[model samples]
Target: MHKRKISIYCYLVSAAFIIGLLSISMFISYSKDPTSSAKDDNQLEYVTPEEVGYSSEKLNEA
Candidate 1:
């Protein structure tokens, strides 16, 4: 009787944990997408062109 109770408890706990993890993952991905998430929340920071393999000087020359 004790063994059966323990197994049921374990199953419930595992199911809860899995559901929580899935929800968190979905939230994170949904919030990261620019089109799907709010635009005001996803502000773009200025990054140097050099950091992304483009030369800032050459860009300025154009």
Candidate 2:
């Protein structure tokens, strides 16, 4: 009876430990992916407004 109680306790403790570890792993796994600002750092080429479609005259009105 004593050995059985100890074994049960040990099993419960191990189960709790495993659950804690699994929760931590899931939390880490679901966290946002690492993003790099390097790709987002794209520099657009400067161009005259007329080159696209906006007229310089209309731009002056604003």
Candidate 3:
């Protein structure tokens, strides 16, 4: 009888632990900002190497 009680307690504890882990994973997966991966409208425009005061030939050599 004592062994049966111990087994039941262990099973409940293990099940509770698994449930807690699943809930935490679900929360993390769902809590992310969906728009964070989208491109922003304020992005910088493209510029050539020489326009930024750097030589294109030297940049290519390195």
Candidate 4:
């Protein structure tokens, strides 16, 4: 029937619209700056306890 065909066409168009929106959103999310994820100004620094005035022997006892 013609009505059935129209219903199918509408369903296909709606599905395609949803897929397009999802792909656009995904692309926007992935294209953002990678460094923007860091929320803090103080990043972790690699340093030994001895440099901070802590003895290695005392750490090993714990």
- Which candidate leads in lDDT? 3
lDDT of 4 by residue, 1-59 (tens): 99999999999999999999999999988885776766655778878999999998999
- TM-scores, all candidates, are 0.51, 0.53, 0.53, 0.53
lDDT of each: 0.88, 0.89, 0.93, 0.91
How much RMSD separates candidate 2 from the native structure? 5.5
> Between prediction 2 and prediction 4, which has the larger lDDT?
4
Per-residue accuracy of model 2 over 4-62 as CA lDDT, tens digit each: 99999999999999999999999989985577445444667789999998999989999
As for lDDT, the candidate ahead, 1 or 3, is 3
Give the candidate order by descending lDDT: 3, 4, 2, 1
Ranking, TM-score, top scorer first: 3, 2, 4, 1
Candidate 4 residue-wise lDDT at 62: 94
- Report lDDT (Cα) of residue 14, candidate 4: 100
Each candidate's clash count: 0, 0, 0, 0
Return the TM-score for candidate 1, rounded to 2 decimals: 0.51
Q: Supply the global lDDT for candidate 4.
A: 0.91
Q: List, residue by residue over 1-62, the lDDT tens digit for candidate 3.
A: 99999999999999999999999999989895776987777889899998999999999999
